[model samples]
Target: MKKLFTTDFKQRCINLMLHEQHTVAETSKIMNVSISALQRWKVQYIKEKQGITPVKPAITAEQREIQRLRTEVEQLRSDNALLKKVSAFFLDKH
Candidate 1:
């Protein structure tokens, strides 16, 4: 029998490899997934990033929402940092 993995689990594995800078071998051992599966997931992730639909393990709606929110949070943080710099500059002038 084959083991079925959840979308969230797959996403976490990809994140570990991409964001955390883990090698495929390390991710496979740590996540207990096969190297082949990790490679496939990486390909799918790249395709998705390029705006192409993946062949399998399609990203769920919830995952898409989370990604969107993460991007929004990053943008907001950048804006906040700029605002703080501007405020400090004005304070120094006055």
Candidate 2:
């Protein structure tokens, strides 16, 4: 995949495509991003541009902690399995 673009550049391109009513091809050409990529951003921009203020991402700290705990649990389970295999190998040899 191509390198990700900066937030400002992407928003600028989306604004041009949405607010200024520029064609996706023209916006992509001006912003130097792929037309398909520009189209995707335009979809999001158009959705949120409706009412007074923009809605922010809804993730909470508790949700983030839950995700972190899930990852740690997966890692610990993997480590325990490896340790069990090692212990069984030593027992079998001795």
Best by TM-score: 1
Kindly report which residue stretches of model 1 are placed more than 4 angstroms away from their true locations once superposed. Answer: 60-94
Q: Candidate 2 residues 1-94, lDDT tens each?
A: 6677765677788778767999999987887888888776666555444421223321233433555666799999999999999999999999
Candidate 1, 12: how far from true, in Å?
0.5
Error of 1 at 49 (Å): 0.9
Runs of candidate 2 with Cα error greater than 4 angstroms are 50-94
lDDT of 1 at 54: 46
- Report every candidate's CA lDDT: 0.83, 0.68
Clashing pairs in 1: none
